[model samples]
Target: MIARAASALLVASWLVVGPTPAAQAAPATATCTSSVGPGIPPPAGLAAGVPGFHAQWYGQSGYPTLCPGERSTATVAYYNSGSRGWVNGRMGEVAYLGTWGPEPGQDQVTPLGGDGTNGSPATGWPRYNRIAIQPAPYVGPSQVAWFQFTIQAPVQAGSYRLYLRPLVEGATWLEDFGVFWLVTVLNADGTPPSPPAPPVLGTGYGFQNVATARGTFGVHLVKERLADVTVKTLTANTTECLNNCPAKPLAQYAAETNAYAGMNGTYLCPPDYAACAGKVNSYDYAVYNSTLRRWLNYNALNGQNGLLAFNGTTTSVYRRSFVYFQQQTPVTAAITNYPLLLQNGAVISSEAEQSASQLAKGTKGAIGVDGTYVYLVIATNANVTDLAYVMQALGARDGLNLDGGGTAAMWIGGSYKVGPGRLLPNAIVLTKP
Candidate 1:
């Protein structure tokens, strides 16, 4: 968890085009037949013997944070609810697994076809060794055919999804019901992308991306040099921001602050708790701006650790704060948020579970500073530890994680590079010069 335990401190903090045939649902015990007709249909009474296979993926098993071309093992359990038995290399009856993907992130990407990012062409199929067996044949229904496959990830630096399905090679895909695991493949090359240059917008802020052997980073730079930063906030207030709606859109925050660019702010009293989120929620949220009034979370105590940095937009020694500003300088715009990610070039402890993406990865929103430039990062696919590493490599001497999943969002140049699914309660806005 990049969220550090603060004694008292600021806390803060895609799809591919596919045949729109309905993605069907089948229980582990349900006998499912292929909706997509098979090249070879079962004959006579043999039709009843055709296998009904289903799969479930447990990503934490062997899926690692891999780079393009890196080989990793994936564990999958198959369930059979048919009268036939699965045999390895048994011609048409062998039930094996195969994977291929344009990956999910591609749907969100603006493909530069000439640069190998063509969306129409089927790509991202790893050179997989044929496994013509199901480890063991099943004699009855409701049996699990568990097996593992070692395959390589695509050679790219972005989010990806490996679509896995059970198949009989030449027969047909185990369509309708299958799993696609999201992956974050960092660049094999150690090159950070050049700063973003808007086509026509005069917003001085730079919206760019960097890729490396680590992963990809979508960076929103406030300035070229160590420009001073003034953090802005939008708490619940009836007169401002569309009645200070439970969650304001990211663009709304940018417009109100006249921000050149910005991303969603600290996590709020989620709307799912609508009974408590609207006007009468009292969940001791903490902040140390001294300029704002917030419910106290025991004035920032132990065990509550998640912190980013103050004086972010400057070239200075990285200092972390918990109960007090470690630098002794008064924190002008600080929030009581936590698990500080980086401090003076060292990575703060981060746990895998902090990011609750079932596959160990998902959308991420973060704030970081390399002591010279403050950066706002939004990742459509990645875990917390991976995100922290990407920020650290970007020269972030001090960094912190922010709310992610559905609440993560980013807007620049009057457009959302990555829009949110719902409104946001607060945001970290960048006032452009």
Candidate 2:
């Protein structure tokens, strides 16, 4: 099931196209079989032994990025490869696309659709769990049907996936074609929403007191020419894991790599949260593991997150996209994070869509670069916006926000300066070559 699903996603990635306008509403009903034409090839790789009802994926519209409460049209095409004909509104014969995957069941209700009371992003779906049905009343074998639907992005800013499969209501599910859509939600200005608050700082951690124009911050900072230190991203696991993943403290990461300085890497699903039960400690950002010479969660490299990379002594900061970095080679270290705090020495973190925790005074962490020098900082009693000012005050040309709250931590010269806070799955480390 996993292999087939991956293959389907790979195919979809190649055929992505820009969003099209919402399709016109279909007439009450129509005969679609007559539209079948000659020279059309049969779909390849139909599931065997499921002659009664089967489907072959044809094509789908491009994935879209939307703001909260915004809506967009989406379409998917499929070829009927089964022996039976689909009849509209007929029990045991009507074909419909239902939510599936990321789980142990099918026909699950997705938050992207349904009545407003069901935590749906928007209303007007055929049903909470149903995405769409074939536009025509009957679809004969070898005929292709187009399914159109609307997707409303949720209020939260993050990437969301909706898995779908075709089935005849009250009958067996069709072939597992492994179809899904990836939607990204950001603020109206295209900035990431503020993250959740970090845990309160514990006493006795050593930090340099620095006062900036924005506010005072207790910081664990390092200023070194790139040539003097090799920066690398280290991970506890060699590969990705959804839950029960290996994680270790900042000191352990520093010791293992002989790193002189280190800090937490990215936002993650913490084990303590009830919502993280099935996927504890799983993070979705891309990070290149220097020791392994590979990217974990590599698929996320194509997203709109902020990326910081080091190619030997050359450091590059990407504010919104990783396409350019994707083509670069020989990168010694790399990590992606959200809501780029500073760009070109100017504050850029958005105040829009900031949660109460993000706006409230709390601990915040960030990594930044100025000229040939790099910096690691953990500020006290601050907000996301304050981090930008702090980075600017530190003379950073560009900066990116790291994981904060309980996940915030930093180590320097064989000991922790900010935290031995929470265990980390990944960390950015600096070591002498």
Candidate 3:
């Protein structure tokens, strides 16, 4: 009786275990079939590769042409050809798009990632080398996953390529579908649709309403080569102006100096303001008259103000306190203004000590040099800080903020490109010798 009962128990155990392996193997076989259902189909042009954690390139959005320092959205689609499902936020199962190729390059850093010391082109990336991840929570076999990310073009204009490949992070990289994004970065123009022509040697006028990550600004400028022109400061008064100072329109200053281009000078007390009741049209900054070959307000040169000087052969921008330049450099023309904008290709202006007027958004003027050329700029609807970025965009190695607001003005090629906004006690002019 004990043997019969044991045999019956053994038979019952077989009944339970007999179908378990087939049931398990059935799903495993289906997992490798490469098809999800009747309506689901494998991606076109899909090639057989890795059995698990594999991906097939499906499609992507059109490549974009971006301006330097501009951001744009991009999307890439990948069909899961692997046996496993991509699980979001899972260490081993999560899939990511990583920088790849140029041969032997896998997970390489790219300028599009903005991970370098220069700064990011786009923000909110998973990692410096990781581009993006599957947007859905799970991407099963034969399903498509669309990964979206933002790309910020580098501040240089050129064709940029980012080779990309999918990988199951912490597991294995997927097939080398050999995909890449070819992005074109154009020259700086506010809404730049195409690459601008090469910068010419002579003066030219244009309005640059640029769009940046910070905001948009409208800047009018006169660009010229320092080698082709002489840069000088022309003051209406022969000496320093205290009160009831003589001021002239920008056109007159340009006419008298035979200047091809000109802009307003350093900050001053305008007659329109009640604060300038006694000091109407008065300014205390130091300026060198090229016509007279003497420095105006020479005593004020000891203060902490940015100095821009030209010695007929080269241009120089002194950050603050030009005592050394005054004593050593025999500059033909020099002018002093508060708050240097850029130094050595970097924005150095701080709004900490700025007055409310200086901090406000209005017309702002600046003078900048890129070692090869000089730029006289007038930015509308911008502040001191914004002017710094504008100068940087103009490729200025060093820049200085000049007087602006209603006093802002710029004359180029015998016409006012920006303003004749208000009369100026002094002006910076570009003349052909």
List all candidate RMSDs to the true structure. Answer: 16.4, 18.1, 24.0
Cα lDDT tens digits for candidate 1, 1-433: 0111211211101111211122221111122121111111111111122335332222223223444444443444444534445555567667655542223231232211111233421222222323224655442343454444443445555554454446655554442122434344445553322333432212245444445455554443333234644554444332222222445688887787676677776655443333343443222333333225332243442335554424444322222334443334544344444445666777766564342332245456677766556767765435566677767766666777776655667777787665543566556666646
- Choose 1 or 3, whichever is better by TM-score: 3
Candidate 3: clashing pairs of residues = 114-120, 190-209
Whole-model Cα lDDT per candidate?
Answer: 0.45, 0.68, 0.70
Q: At residue 384, what lDDT does model 3 achieve?
A: 85
| lDDT minimum window of 10 residues, candidate 2 | 31-40
lDDT of 2 by residue, 15-34 (tens): 22334323332221132110
Candidate 2 or 1, higher lDDT: 2
Cα deviation in Å at residue 276, candidate 2?
A: 1.1
lDDT of 2 at 82: 65
* Cα-based lDDT at residue 239, candidate 1: 24
List of clashing residue pairs for candidate 2: 198-405, 199-405, 199-406
Per-model TM-score on C-alpha atoms: 0.49, 0.51, 0.54
